[model samples]
Target: MGFWDFLKPRSKEHVEACWPGGKMLQVHMEYDTEKTIFTYFGRFGLTFNISKSQLTGAIVKEISRTHSVLQVYSGVDCVGTTDILPTEACNIMKDWLGQY
Candidate 1:
């Protein structure tokens, strides 16, 4: 690997959620080290390379012990929101992305 590549932090891939196509969501913790920012990066629909962001643009919340809230957005607008299991977060994100 190149020097710069060696310096870069490795990313963890979430294969459970596949989108836009062959790409899976990737999470990088404290990616830059300098900024110490955790980032989620993935592509959407082939043409767009979404960054800092996953399946990063998606938000999951726990409203109850048995149910979680899944929220997806397109830009500033919230595209979809529904209560779901925590395990369903990625799957729900895929569905919203497909529809919106």
Candidate 2:
């Protein structure tokens, strides 16, 4: 198996291993609608947008989206990048895990 393939499942397993205190979250970005929504436990939900940055806070706790917009926010550093948007999803995920 490829390195990425091996790493992917191992990482996911690590996440799963940290459940209850942790969660499997789904973050959805609708390209057609320009909306972002988060789903948890396949039911609980929350949503966000670039315009509503204040309520979400300076650091996001987690994100699990299917779109590349998450990539656009990932690893970005600038007032324009972070002030208007939360930090990268991966950054949030790492922070969450470290809390454990």
Candidate 3:
């Protein structure tokens, strides 16, 4: 399965009860060579990273406990130049959010 598949939207009633104008995001990381999705509440200043995978990225929106997926934006490969790669998008998200 691809990433961002583990998260599910929360109930409408619950979302309506919370603050308005808040965005949502979900994240999934590889652990023991297996993917593990984890939901977290985040605003515009959250980030996380993984050294082994050499990934990084930031939360572009607010998320809820029901969020458990991530939409890749940018990333980099451990080999070759240090330039950002699509693979490192997840890492960038985590680093900016300090979720490492």
Q: What would the per-residue lDDT of candidate 1 be over residues 7-99, giving only the tens digit for each residue?
A: 677553432223322233331111333333322332221112233333235566667665565555557755445433443544555454443
Top TM-score prediction, candidate number: 1
* Order of models, best lDDT first: 1, 3, 2
Q: How does residue 93 of candidate 2 score in lDDT?
A: 37
User: What is the C-alpha RMSD, rounded to one decimal, of candidate 3?
Assistant: 13.2
TM-score against native, each model: 0.29, 0.19, 0.19
Kindly list the per-residue Cα lDDT of model 2 for residues 1-100, writing each as its tens digit: 3435424632222122212222334432221112222112212333333332322323332333421112223234321111112234435433433342
Q: What is the lDDT of residue 63 in candidate 2?
A: 35
Please write out the lDDT profile of model 3 over residues 1-100, one tens digit for every residue: 2355337553333111111122332322322223322223233324343333344443333243333234332364222121122344434435533543
Cα-based lDDT for every prediction:
0.40, 0.28, 0.32
Query: Which wins on lDDT, candidate 1 or candidate 2?
Result: 1
Q: In order, what is each prediction's RMSD in angstroms?
A: 11.9, 14.6, 13.2
